[model samples]
Target: MPVAPAPPAAPAYADPQGSLRASDADRDRIADILAEALAEGRLDAEEHAERVEAVYRAKTVGELEPIVRDLPAAPGRTAAAPRPEPVPAAYGPEDVEGNADQLLAVFSSTTRKGRWRVARRTNAFAVFGNIEIDLTEAIFAQPLTTINATSIFGNIEVRVPENISLRGTGTGILGNFEVTSLEGVDPQAPLVVVNGYALCGNVEARPKRGKWVVDLQSKIRKHLGH
Candidate 1:
């Protein structure tokens, strides 16, 4: 029957293993490698940030291969030698006193701005109201701060500094939950994790324009000097 229309050519990949789908653990491994590369001066801040961002966006194993092809072999893989641990950066005091752990807004707008201390975990609830959390000038008392936001027919907005990493694992049901994942240059920068749900409402976390953690390294140095 017309020579069976000839057999279709098979798709190909540089490495057969690359054709596999990448799991969350695979992405995490790659991120760790990039962090190590950044710490070891193998890759600059921009490169590290870009690669890390790509790592999160990668869908298939093939997509992750090129990201770390030039870098040293990842852990558990064949390598000439083992990699060394990076020195930890000094952090400022984690002032948890007087920090608000729960923010509720019902039919009114609630805003948390200016200089303040961020607790290890904060919950924001907006029921038929609005809640705003700005961290550009806020102090982080922990390396990892989690924000649990719930919006029921309302809105919750979170603004973060540009020098800190941001992550979101929220969902939306007949609503919108959006968070732009960002990887900051400083490896020691605090990580802000947003996790919650939006029910017929909206929740968003993003970097405020022209806002950054002023002199992060200098602040760390000053903290160490004390």
Candidate 2:
């Protein structure tokens, strides 16, 4: 008599009760579903944003289930294969050498904006002039970027996209040092840290309105011409 064939092994994280811990890939998949819903007019921008935020905050598969339970099933999504994590566009050491890491403005206004590669660390100095560093349309070479700003009788303003994280550890001496801290919903979003001093001048860091980083998966798909 022939023996019965062995039972198929369960898929990874195929808990019928959905009690397994969620991974980054899990969150990303749920986020993609929400994005599709928004695009189809099933969810408004506000609702989509809120659900995306929840997707990142979910710690378990159970928590992620309710986020898109009402949405239509995603196309081509299967449990047979695990979703791959997104790889962001990063600059290598050779690429870093080509990007400007320092900005100086002495008695003249200077600005660094548009589609530029940002280094891991940047130094900005403003003396009796204005220096503006806009990262709304910039490419992040790394996950975290530090900006060392110094203003002496001048001004230094740093603008970042609204969807990226922003932090400040700078101080003001007989001047103003202001930074509007923000925490982004996407875990893969870039982080900007501003640190330095402002002496008899102004140093400000804030999010640029109506500017945001595209969805990580969406960006990757576009790069692959999908």
Candidate 3:
């Protein structure tokens, strides 16, 4: 029999968070990085524009890696050896982690949404109650945040905006633990890891909508200098 070829190793820059989404700010940061590279003669103008367009269209960090993989880091930065895999740190220095926060609901319902600062580590609990966490307008303390949640005879729900990445590894024992956003992730985007257990209850994660409208409104306000 002929020898079978070994499978290729996975790219290291591949988004470990899985199908998480990207954000406008994430895209802008990459664009800035590309712009800097262009000014520094690391990338030609054509390549820079092309990469910027792709950056805007990119829904995840995985899509943004190849654009600058071959370019050298800024003048002051130490360049690491090149590999066949993608490198998350090569993108820039803005993707740092944040502090820690917590949320809990016991025999009642607790909801957190709107614009708020998220810690690097967040602990959420729902015991005979309900808990909802929405990150549509959240400001993360770090580029990657971990959410540890537990639901017992209650419900725990997480709502994230599009383009942000989510890795949900929660398990359910005689209950339900579901993660709806697990496709087309970006390694450079903010990573939110959802982990925990649900007992006789439900734990779910999914994406939100209407961010474009918000973006448009912000642009209009800025255009008018309001």
lDDT of each: 0.78, 0.75, 0.64
Pairwise TM-score winner, candidates 1 and 3: 1
The runs of at least 3 residues in candidate 3 whose Cα sits more than 4 Å from the true structure, single-residue gaps closed, are 1-99, 183-187, 212-226
lDDT score of model 1?
0.78
Native-to-model Cα distance after best TM-score fit, residue 88 in candidate 3, in Å = 12
Q: What are the per-residue Cα lDDT tens digits for candidate 3 across 122-189? A: 78889999999998787654445567789999999998877665656668999999877432133334
Candidate 3, overall lDDT? 0.64
Candidate 2 deviant stretches above 4 angstroms: 1-86, 89-100, 215-217, 220-226
- TM-score attained by model 1: 0.60
Best by the lDDT measure: 1
User: Residue 130 in candidate 3 has what lDDT?
Assistant: 95
Count backbone overlaps in model 1.
0
Error of 1 at 215 (Å): 2.7
- Clashing pairs counted in every model: 0, 0, 14
| TM-scores, all models, native as reference | 0.60, 0.56, 0.52
Model 2 TM-score on a 0 to 1 scale: 0.56
